[model samples]
Target: MHLILEQGDLTTVAVDAIVNAANSSLLGGGGVDGAIHAAAGPRLLEACRELRRTTLPDGLPVGEAVATPGFDLPAAWVIHTVGPNRHAGQTDPELLVSCFGRSLDVAADLRARTVAFPAVGAGVYGWAADDVARAGVAAVRSWDDANPGALDEVRFVLFGPAVLAAFEDALASV
Candidate 1:
């Protein structure tokens, strides 16, 4: 996969899938999750509700990813993954890495050529931007190395300058 570090809105990215940094409920919370849910319209929430009813009865676990239709968004699919809550004492970097790797795995299963990702665990979850960037970039790079042609492009669609800079540095080193 060709990794791109971009500072922009995840909702408008033209890709096969956009990975949402969702909560366990998948019912749409704040930050990237809220933005994606809002941009994709009501159908996105409806789909999430259906998933909760059928597949994810308890709720999506941290670091696990599931796919839903993008609805009104530009992407064909919306991949939702719950990141670890650092403030809640979930400080494992492996779980943070899983957020990226599992999302890529889901995208590969969907045969998605391009995917966009937000800075998972970096907002209300209380993870530092630099740490998130390192784990995210490393996870994606590791996956790309393991699965040669799985995806054509994977963009880190950062929301702000600080995170974008962190991701850029991480990308450079990786």
Candidate 2:
């Protein structure tokens, strides 16, 4: 898989799928989650609500992922995964890796050739950007190694300079 990194809003990226750093509720929250929800419009919320009402009554679990139609957004599908909240006593790096790994799995299962991702757990969730980047890169590398021809591109659509820099550094070492 090709790993691309850039600082931008994930909502506007035109990929086969974009991963949302969602809360377990999967309704809508701040940061990447909020931006994606807003960009995808009301139908996205309805799909999430239906997800909650039918399949995921207790909400999506941290590190696990699910997909929804992107609606008004540029992408065809939105892969939603809940990152571990460090401030909430979830500080495991494996949890962070799981977010990336599972999101990729969902994207591949959807047969999406190109996917975009946010810096999961690196915003309001309280994880350092460096740590998040490192884990994310490592997860992508591992997944790519296991499934070499599964994807055409994996893009990290970051929000700020700091996060982009972290991914740049991590990817450089890869």
Candidate 3:
């Protein structure tokens, strides 16, 4: 999957899957997590709760991901990836990269052709937008090379101009 840079609403993407910057609880929270939960309807929350009850560990850390259907969004599935909180340091960087990589792997497992990913950890998590962009682009590039044609398109969807610009710069460099 070759990464493509795009600035748009994630809910509107007609991709096979969209990566949601979710919390460890897998429940709705603020930022991209909340938006995705809201758009996906109440069923999404219910699904998360059920999944947590059966499969999720008792005290799992962040950077883990779970997959669910997109109840209302255009994409067929949603990959809920838990990113680190503010000031998490180097661990945050690696976790953030893993978030992207894990989401891609989930998408690939589902045979997704196109996938959209938001800037993981860049909102309430307080990761610098530029750093997130850089790590995300790098992770996607590496994954694409390692698993050629695993996905046809991988889009970086930014919510704002600043994030979009950062992703554009990162994409150019990669």
Candidate 4:
């Protein structure tokens, strides 16, 4: 896989899949999750509701990922993953890394050649942007090394200069 960095709205990224930094409920929360749900329209919520009613009645677990159609968005699929909430005492960096790795796994399962990701566990989750970037970049790089041609491209679609700078540093170092 090819790793790249871009500071932009993840909803508009033209990839096969975009990773949502979702809360456990997966019902549309703030940040990237809300943006994605809003951009994808009502069907996205309905799909999430169906997932909840059927498969994920207990809501999605932290560091795990599940997929739904992208609906009105540019991407073909939306891969939602819950990040560890540091305020809730979920402080392990491994948990944050799992979010990226598992999302990549879902994208690989869907046979997606390209994927975009947000800064999971960052901001409101209480994780530093630098920490999130390091874990995310390392996880993706590790997966790419192990999987080889599984994906053609993976982009860190960050929200601002700070996060983008962190990811850029991680990409260079890790």
Per-candidate TM equals: 0.99, 0.99, 0.94, 0.99
Task: Give the runs in model 3 whose Cα sits over 4 Å from its true position.
Answer: 57-60, 88-91
Worst ten in a row by lDDT for model 2: 1-10
- Please rank every candidate by lDDT, starting with the best: 1, 2, 4, 3
Tens-digit lDDT track of model 2 for 1-174: 789999988998999999999999999998899999999999999999999999999999999999999999999999999999999999999999999999999999999999999999999999999999999999999999999999999999998998999999999988
In model 2, the clashing pairs are none
Model 2 quality (TM-score): 0.99
lDDT of each: 0.96, 0.96, 0.86, 0.95
Off by over 4 Å in 4: none
Off by over 4 Å in 2: none
Candidate 1 C-alpha lDDT tens digits along 4-117: 998899999999999999999999999999999999999999999999999999999999999999999999999999999999999999999999999999999999999999
In Å, residue 33's CA in model 1 sits off its true spot by 0.5
Q: RMSD in angstroms, candidate 2? A: 0.6
Q: Candidate 1 has which clashing residue pairs, if any?
A: none
By TM-score, the better pick of 2 and 3 is 2
- For model 4, how does the per-residue alpha-carbon lDDT over 5-96 read when each residue is reduced to its tens digit? 99999999999999999989889999888999999999999999999999999999999999999999999999999999999999999999
